[model samples]
Target: MERKKKTGFARYINLVNLGVFVVVTSVSLPIYWLVISSLKQPVAIGASPPQYIPSPFSFANYQQAFSQYGFSQYFINSMIVTVAATILVLGLGSLAGYGLARLPMRGKTTIMLTLLVISLFPGIAVIPPLYLMMRTIGWLNSYQALIVPYTAFNLPFAIWILRNYFLGLPKEMEETGRIDGASPLRIYWSIILPQALPGLFTAGVFTFTACWTEFLMALTLNNSNSFRTIPVGIALFGTPFNIPYGTIFAASVVAVVPIGILVFVFRKSVVSGLTSGAVKG
Candidate 1:
């Protein structure tokens, strides 16, 4: 009777899991169908029910996006800006966060609150002055225009995340480093920073994604093709009258895959980083 009860419970659990799988698959099927439809030829794509798989699996859409839109240049530009910005945010933000967490100073709370408030403001709110400043510095239509602003705008949020994570860590670790004759910067670089890897990864990933997908600033700031990033280039798929759904969809998939992989591969670290000291403070 005991064995039979255990087997029955196992079967019930399996059935519940199968039901969940089916529901999830059902929800995702439409999205899969939409993406597959982009790879299909226009004639077949416009058909009544639409096809899941493309007939010939044509590379035409990707080819067109590359050739006509100069998407390759845009992709490279976006990659450069995103990577550089992510690095800056990680390095500077980590240090700033550490300082905010450990160092005592006058009006630190006021300064931190000010930063949080500024970060909460919408991009459009500051675009006019920011644009004029960029133009005055002659950074308009240059890589610096995009990368500098991307890093600066993202820094506040990154700092806050790192600060929170740092606050969670115990002070004993830093004391141990200092007892071993480590200076402030040395202690930060070797001890506290290393321990905050998870938070760093999480912040870096978020910053990278934000910079990668940012469109409004990229569109307005870069008028020339040479400085255009992926989001701006993707916008070209839609003219006044017509939109190239296939090319847009394919490029979007291309854009998303890397980010998806990045987060997926580092998910454990990101989660661990975010939740590391949640229970304490």
Candidate 2:
């Protein structure tokens, strides 16, 4: 009977391992293909037989993406919008989260729920009014057009994450700061925020990713090539006559690098923030 139990446990472990392997392989295969396809020569990209391994890897696609396709400008535009939006989200979110978590505000739950509902609204639903507003304010084809909307859209989630994190922090710290005569703002800036770094990083990374990859707003808001972002620019890469798949793949790889680096660097913080208040001992 003991031997049979042990055998069953071993089989279960093996099955779990096999499942993980299959999941990893399924997700990684496309990424592998994208990388290799980006390295392939333009003519070989659509070859009669697919080149799983790029023979004589060429960076010509990358070069053309930057030089001919003006991906550099698109990249710069995306960086500007993403960074600006993330900064605003973090700054405003931390304050709102702290207020909601610690302050004696009435209807805080209602406010939070409303924000959540707003966040759930489809981007398409809001675009027409947003476009009209931007046009009315003369913000179309400008960085603020994207930055303002991105900040507003991402703020609610950031606040939700940060509020939960703040709730998990000990109230004694704030009380002690008050005893020492530290201002509320000082306590928040120096005491609470330092300890909430993980939440902040998580919020910032999410906001950056959303703003970076956003398409519909970036597409509809800015028609000028000078103001175009990576997603829109990539979409408009080729004319009706010819599409450059290799260049598109190369641009995609480049676009993915920043997000990958960010996730790799802040992975621990993201995990901790996500699970901070999930379990209580």
Candidate 3:
């Protein structure tokens, strides 16, 4: 009877898990449908009782999108912006975080609080001022317009993330480095940074993702086709007689490739960094 009860309990748990999986899968159907329909013609997608599967898979959309839209150039612009932003966040955020966490500064709390408060404002609200500043500097419609401003905007949040993780770290590590005759930069570079991999990776991955999918800022800052990013390119697919559904979908899928790969590569760091932050004071 005890063995039977144990078996029944295990079976019940398995059934519950299956039910949950099915529900989650059902919720994801629309997104899956969108991706699938991106491979089909607009007419087929607009038809009643929409087709989930393409009758004949097509690469024409991808070809046309690349050939006509300068999607390749847009992709390159995105890559440059994302890479530069990620590197800046990692280096600058880490250094700033280490200083804030370890080094003493007069009125540090007041300044840190001010920065944190300013950082909390939504990016949309800052757009007007940011655009004006960029314009004054004659950076409007250039990659520099996006790169420099985005780094500044994203820096504070990255600083906070790294600072929290740095604060969580015990001072014993830095002390050990000091006893070994390490200077501040040496300690940060050789000792503290190596151990802070998870935090740095978390910041880097987040920055990369943000920089990649930044639609409003990219759209507002750039007007020319050659300077546009993937999101902006995708947005232009709407048309009167020929809505380019397939092309948009294909581009979107391509856009997701880098984000997906980055997440896959650094997923471990994300999980660890998050769990550490939560469990610590």
Candidate 4:
């Protein structure tokens, strides 16, 4: 009876594993197909029943994306925008979070709720005002146009994450710093900051991903070919006359690579950040 029960439990575990594998594959198959399709020639891309493998694998599509359509410049623009915005978000968000968590305020709860509400506002709703403000300030077609807005829009979530993480930290160290005559900034820099690495990385990764994948603001804030980021460049890849599916697919795969690499690198930090507040320690 014991052996039969163990066998049944093992079979159930196998079934669960199979279900998870199926779900993961179902989601990943499209991405797999996209990557495979990118390797094919233009002629093979749209072949009926779809060619599972490239008939003659070629790097021509990738070359066209980078060289002919200027993905290289778009990539640089995206990097600048993503890196700058992420820095801004992490800096401002950490400071804001520290303040909200540590400082005594009469309406702090209300203030945090307001921030959460502000973050929930539709991005589309703010575009007109943001566009006009950027135009009025003569920041149009500038990296600042995208970077600044991305920072502002992503700040609330960063602040929320960091603040919750901060709240979970023991106050003993902070109190000791206070007695040692360390300035508030010094305490934050030395005491709180070191302990908050996971939170900072979490906020930074979130901000980076947001800025990297952002499209609407990228499209609206800049119109110059030189200023366009990857999304816009990819969207406008083919003329109205011809859509280069292979090149588009190749560009998409290229675009996804950086984000995947980033997440893979910082994945441990992200996991730590998310789980930091779950238990007492």
Candidate 5:
């Protein structure tokens, strides 16, 4: 009986391992292909019997993306919009989250529910109205056009994450600060914000990623080359007659680098923030 039980447990463990292997491979294969494709020379990219491994790895595509295709401008535009939006989201979200989590206010539940609903509204559903508004205000084809919308759209999720994180913190800390005659803002800035680093990092990462990869709004709002983002710029890479797959792949790899680095650096904090407040109000 003991031997049979051991065999069954081993079989289960093997199955779980196989499942993990399959999932990892499925996710990684495409990324591997993209990286390899980016490294291959332009002619070699679509060669017969696609090169699984780039024979003569060359960075000509990357150079062409930056110098020839003006991807540098797109990269800069994306960085500006993403960074500005992320900063605004974090600054505004922390305050709103702290208030919702700690303050004694009427209709708090209703407000939170409303925020969740608003966040769920699809970008496509709201784009027409947003485009009209931007056009009316003469903000079309500008950085603020994208930055403002990104901040507004990402703020709710940041607030929810932060509010939940704040709730999980000890109330006694706030009470102690109050006893010391510390103002709410002072206490929050000094005591609360420091401990909420994990939540902040998580929110920042998510907001940054969203703003970086956002397509529909970016495309609709900023159509001009001067204001085009990575996604928009990548889409317009080559003319209909001749497509530049190598350059597109290189640009994509470049765009993915920042996000990959950010996530990797803050991975632990992100994991902790996401899980810590999950069950705490």
Candidate 6:
């Protein structure tokens, strides 16, 4: 009887795993098709039956996007803004999170709730004010226009994640550092921060992705062709009358490739942070 029950449990687990695999594959099909379609000739892309395989695969679409559409400059602009914003978000968020988690404070819950509310505001809602502010500061059409907003928008979630991770850590760690005559900042910088690697990586990845794909503010704040990012560059990938689907799809793939690599590289850290943050504190 016991062996049979165990066998039944194993079967249930297998069923659940199979269900998950099916769901994942179902969701991934469109993305997979988009990628494959980007490599096809324009004629093959518009074929009657839809060619799943590229008849004559070529990098023509990518070449057109990079050379004709000015994706190279846009890509560089994107990298600058995304990297700067991610760094700012991680630094500020981790510091703020550490303070909230470890330091004695009043109305901490209220403060945290306020931050959550701020983050909940839609990006569109703040565009007018942010645009005006940037114009006043002479920052319009500059990298700061994108970087600053990205950092501000991403900081709340970064802080929430880092604060939770910090709380989950044992107070004894800080106390032990204090016993060694270490300053609070020293403890955080030298000891606490190192142990928070997984959480940092998780927050960094989130901030980077958000900064990378952001479009509305990037569009609203900058009007110059020289300052456009990948999303904006891809959006303008055609004449007034014609939209090139294959070229746009290729650009889309290029836009997403960095994010995919980032996730793959730091996947273990992300999983660790998520698991630890979920259970601890």
User: Which candidate wins on lDDT?
Assistant: 5
For model 4, state the Cα shift of residue 35 in Å: 1.1
Q: 254-273 in candidate 2: lDDT tens per residue?
A: 99999999999999998888
lDDT tens per residue, model 1, 54-124: 88787777787788877789899999999999999999999998898898878888878988897998998
Candidate 3 lDDT over 51-134, as tens digits, reads: 768877667777877897778988998999889888987899999988988887888677678778877868898788888988
Give lDDT: candidate 5, residue 142: 98
True lDDT of residue 28, candidate 6: 99
lDDT of 4 by residue, 123-145 (tens): 99999999999999999999999
Q: Candidate 6: what lDDT?
A: 0.91
Candidate 2 structure lDDT? 0.93
TM-scores for candidates 1 onward, in order: 0.87, 0.97, 0.88, 0.94, 0.97, 0.95
Candidate 1 lDDT (Cα, 0 to 1): 0.86
Each candidate's clash count: 0, 0, 0, 0, 0, 0
For candidate 2, list the clashing residue pairs, or say none: none
Report the Cα lDDT for candidate 4: 0.91
Q: What TM-score does structure 3 among the candidates reach?
A: 0.88
| Model 4 lDDT, residue 177, Cα | 98
lDDT per residue as tens, model 5, 1-281: 99999999999999999999999999999999999999999889889999999999999999999999999999999999999999999999999999999989999999999999988989899999999999999999999999999999999999999999999999999999999999999999999999999999999999999999999999999989999999999999999999999999999999999999999999999999989963356
Question: lDDT of all predictions, in order shown?
Answer: 0.86, 0.93, 0.84, 0.91, 0.95, 0.91
Query: What lDDT does candidate 5 reach at residue 141?
Result: 97
Model 4 error, position 20 (Å): 1.3
Worst 10 residues of 1 by lDDT: 272-281
lDDT score, residue 63, model 2?
99
Candidates sorted on TM-score, descending: 5, 2, 6, 4, 3, 1
